[model samples]
Target: MRDPLSKKVVTIEPSGIRKFFDIVSEMKDAISLGVGEPDFDTPWHIREEGIYSLEKGRTFYTSNSGIKELKIEICRYLNRRFGLYYDYDHEAIVTVGGSEAIDIALRAMLDPEDEVLVPQPSYVSYVPCVVLAGGKPVIIELKEEDEFKLTREGLLNAITDKTKVLVLPFPNNPTGSVMTKEDLAEIVPVLIEKDLFVISDEIYSELTYGRDHVSIAEFPGMRERTIVINGFSKSYAMTGWRLGYAVGPAAIIEQMIKIHQFAIMCAPTTSQYAAIEALKNGDGDVEIMREAYDQRRNYLVKAFHDMGLSCFEPFGAFYVFPSIKSLGMTSDEFATKLLMEEKVAVVPGTAFGSCGEGFLRISYAYSIDNLKIAVERIERFVKKHCE
Candidate 1:
């Protein structure tokens, strides 16, 4: 038989984060700190809304862009939370997940070989998505010295004539780095001068600690050029709901919705109704969960330091990226050894990108008790390996 698969699809590697997660799933008594999902349940009020929607038999598909009320609520949430303003009717589209929004946004914007500047040690999907969308993926390896935040020099160095988009994965996954307004200001000029567009993934915005999360869209002259992607998965503990939305200029959003229309008729009706409740009444719930995560974050950072691991303090997201280079093992080797010896599963940093070697991403979304146990096991594993 003739080969049928697109070489582009064949060349992409599977997600490294999921490899360990799958193994840990089958193992008995294994504690997984690998997945970047919230441990909290969907708040009662949100669940109740979904149930009410079902009870009312509202199982029909919404408009290609999504229901008007949900879109309005999304706009309100973005404006109230981050000072971002988008026209609900024309500038937003509900998606299956933040992942889907990312996929379609790239599809809507890129022509073949259009260069996409992606900072590395970011969420795993950006590079693959760019490739699938027929765009060239240019990686900027973020440095730990800069707290893994993308620097102005780094952005300028990666841009060229072909550069069309920059995937801004702030409050970053794996590294837990966030770009402040000052930090963002440094790069906005470069973006404007280069005339580059941005896909700002702000899924972790509400999970920020210490400082308020700032959006690049908030910068002057950026609203039209930036696509903001966010969802309830991280903040409202609604991962399984598979709901996310993208807000941007209407021209771009209109094109994205065309792709979304044929690819996915709409996001789930139940999830949409539930999300309305989440946005309107779930601020307190988010705060409570954020506080718990903050407590766990503090505990784990201290534990890693006490155990002699040089861990950078991450102020956003629930992950701590700790350098395992001192032990003289590759990130994969260290993670595998730790899992086998301690039965604790944590993602190797290489999963995010090649630059993530010598590190490991440990999530603190688990309870304090679980974190304590995991820390104890990690400490023991480190001691054994170091000896």
Candidate 2:
């Protein structure tokens, strides 16, 4: 009998971030900081829109491209916040979530053996999506000293003739690193010179602490070559709504919409309606949540520092990647021992990439009370094993 599974699917590993989640669920009183989900409920105004839609019997399919109102709102939102614009009619496709946008973008553009440069440590889906799209995953390992920003040098060194696309995950998950406009400008020339396309994931664009999140597409000559993927999940606390959008060259978006049309018809009608309210009226709620997250982020950084842990100050997203290399333990061992002994769970940084060894990704999306409890346990565990 022939094997039934596609070898490509078999080669892919499950998400490393969720490795300990099942265990934590069953372990009573465990405080897990591994998940990237926002703790806030969908804001009442946003949820009310969804309820209103249902009450009005607006529970049918939208167009394959999405309702014009939402797409236009997205364009306005991007322009007002990040200084970028797109043709709502031809260049944007509303997706199920940012995850789906990532998958379909890869599917739309990748040809067999097309090399995609994926920077680490990044969101776990980038590599697998590239592979599943029949592209070769070329990893560009971002360094701690560089604060995990992808440098022009790193981009140039990773490119070969086969390289076609680069996945730029900033306001990055796992590490919470961000690339400023200046940082992006340094690499824009490399991309244009090589004629490489970009899939820029900016899902955490709204959660930055000190500076506004800049889009790579904002760089001159980059808007035409970059596919910007963003959504309401992180910013509006609408993760379960499963709504995201991709904006790019109309040619590329046409192909992505073709894939989305056959694979997912449309995003949920209720979610799309709710999302309009999110964009129009949800900014205040998002700002409130962002402030809470910023407070927690600061508390965790100081707690780790006082405990002798080396943690870089992450200005975006809700995570801190703290090094455990000096504690004489691997990231996995440190996380596991802490969970077993103190009922605290964190994702080992290696889940993001091999370069993430000796570090752990702890999310501050939980409440400050939960954060303080977790930090106390972590401090005790660090003392037990510090070199």
Candidate 3:
């Protein structure tokens, strides 16, 4: 029989992060600092809400856009936290996860061969999502010297006449880099000049340290052109809940909702109820978790430095991108050798993009005890290899 699978799906590479995770899962006593998932459970209040929804028999599917109450809470949370305002009725759609919002947003906007400018050393999904939507993925390699934040020169250099979208993955993954308000200001003119729409992935917005997280959508004239993607996953330790939302212009959101209606119908009913409680009463919980992550962040960065690995001090997210160049090994080789020799698993920087070649992404989401153990193992591996 002739092959029935779509060539596009076959051609897309699987997530490199998951490849290492699979290996680590089967290994005995392996400590993983690979995945960015939070080690914390959903706060008791949030979990209780979900349980309450189930106990009350709220198990039916919601409206395609989601429960109206959850949508209102999402809008209120965005405004209260980020100063972003959207019409809860027409401009917001709760999704299965931020991942679904991303996929449907791209599907709603892109035509075949439309170009999307993606900053590299970003989350692995952006490129593949664009490709799957029949859009062209144009990578703009962010520099380590600039602390992996995108610059105006790089933005201008990457944009072409066909460029239709920009994936702004900030409070970014893998590298844990964040773009400050000033940093984002520098690119507004370029985005305006190019007429580009932004898919601002702010999943880690609540995890920022040292300063408040700024959304590009908050910039003047940018709100109409930006789709703000966020969820309870990273911030509330609600990853398993699979609830997220997208906020943008009504025109764009309407189209996205159409795609979502056929594809997902609605996000989980229990999760939406849980998310309502999250938005209403989860601030203290987020603050507590954020403080914990910040402490671990400081500890891990110091540990990397003490071990002679040069690490960028990440101000956001729960991962640190430490340069592995001094050890004279490619990222994959370093990660592989460390996992095999010391039984501590970290994702190779290249799992995010080629620009991550000489780096390794070590998540700080694990507990202090687990992190301390992982650091010791990593130090031992480095000493054995670097000597």
Q: Considering only N, C-alpha and C atoms within 3 Å, which residue pairs clash in candidate 2?
A: none
| Candidate 3 root-mean-square deviation in Å | 0.7
Task: Show where candidate 3 strays beyond 4 Å.
Answer: none
**Predicted candidate 2 versus true structure: per-residue lDDT over 180-250, tens digit per residue:** 98999899999999999999999999999999899999989999999999999999999899999999999
lDDT of 2: 0.93
Scanning candidate 1 in windows of ten residues, the lowest lDDT window is 77-86
**What lDDT score goes with residue 18 in model 1?**
95
By lDDT, who's the top model here? Answer: 1
Off by over 4 Å in 2: none
Ten-residue stretch with the least lDDT total in model 3: 378-387
Ranking the candidates on lDDT from highest down gives 1, 3, 2
Q: Cα lDDT of all candidates, in order?
A: 0.95, 0.93, 0.94
TM-score of each: 0.99, 0.99, 0.99
lDDT of 1 by residue, 231-350 (tens): 989999999999999999999999999999998989999999999999999999999999999999999889989998899999999999999999999999998988888999999999
lDDT of 2 at 358: 90
